[model samples]
Target: MPAARESLLDAAYAALMRRPWSAVRMVDVAVSAGVSRQTLYNEFGSKDGLARALVRREADGYLAGVERALGSAAGPRDRLTATAEWTAGAARENVLVRAMLTGCWTERLPAPPLAPVPSCTAVPAQRRADGPLPTPRDFVRMVRDRAVTVLAGPGASPADTAELLRTCELVVRLALSCVAAPPGEGGMAELVRAVLPRHLV
Candidate 1:
């Protein structure tokens, strides 16, 4: 089932790149995935559901990259710099990333309402029901929380932890700003260096 879902999403993403999201047809996605239309509907409920899943997957991948950047760098400053660079680079290169960063999906199709999943009496539930679907703001908060965790090293003093979290928040805001409106000169790394504490740099 997971493999089938991923195949459907892969098809949808490929279709998105070629045309606006609104133009993508469920039948086409089903055919592309080599699955029946009923299977697609069973998996995602609706186009919006599919989109939410795709966006969540992309966001997870981006966060993984941020984690890698944090681990790869030697110092706090370098880690923040690497993260900023990754964010900016991803936004510039990936259309989906840009849309997620800017919250501007005007070029894509409108997200339709999600249909409810039908109850299956025979099959057991694979996963527990989540409270609610996360909004874009929620995704941003998740990213910030992860950044704070990475920035605040193990055995950090309470005072130091607070300061580091503040720095992480600032860096996240700066990265998002760069995504929304990229700087004409100096680049994202320079922008990050300017806002970061000199001692860390």
Candidate 2:
């Protein structure tokens, strides 16, 4: 089901690049994916549904990159630094990621098809209970939560968890700031280092 949904999303994304989101028809997406229109509708429910899924998938990819950065580094500080660098670099290169980080959509790229609504109001009860769907803001929070856990390590006390949460929140905000307006050269890493305690490093 995921693969099929991805195929549909890839088709929609391709269509979006060629023209405006308003112009990209569901029929065109279905044809591009070699699936029926009903199948597309069944998978996503509507154009808005498809758009949300696409954004979620993109967020998932970005988070996966962060996870990889975390694994590659030697320690907590190094991991946070590497992830920040990676986030800034990736956001610079990818328009979708840039939009997610900065909430600024490009003229060429499709804006999220859904209307603005509070997260709690927009998401269904079942989905909210199961896990909140990955909106861009939710993605940031998700990464922060994961980072807190990683920084805390195993058998963490409440104090350690609280401290790690604060550290991760700071790191994520700094990383996002870099994404919004890049600090050239080694500036991002330096900023991250400045904020972190020596003991954490």
The C-alpha lDDT values of all candidates are: 0.70, 0.75
The list of candidate 2 runs beyond 4 A from truth reads 105-132, 135-137
lDDT of 1 at 143: 61
Question: Relative to the unseen true structure, what is the C-alpha lDDT of residue 138 in candidate 2, on a scale of 0 to 100?
Answer: 67
Per-model RMSD to reference: 3.8, 4.6
- Report model 1's TM-score to 2 decimal places: 0.79
Residue 6 CA displacement from its true place in model 1, Å: 1.1
The residue pairs that clash in candidate 1, if any, are 22-109
Q: Give TM-scores for every candidate, taking all chains together and pairing residue i with residue i.
A: 0.79, 0.77
Q: What is the lDDT of candidate 1?
A: 0.70
**Worst lDDT window (10 residues) for model 1?**
122-131
Q: How big is the positional error of residue 134 in model 1, measured in Å on the Cα after superposition?
A: 4.2
Best by TM-score: 1
Candidate 1 structure quality by residue, lDDT tens digits, 1-201 = 378888987899898888898899999999999999998888766676677666656666677888888788788778887887787778777776666665666657444222233433221221111113344465566666777687776897898767766777777778878876887665766877787666667
Candidate 2 lDDT (Cα, 0 to 1): 0.75
Looking at model 2, the pairs that clash are: none
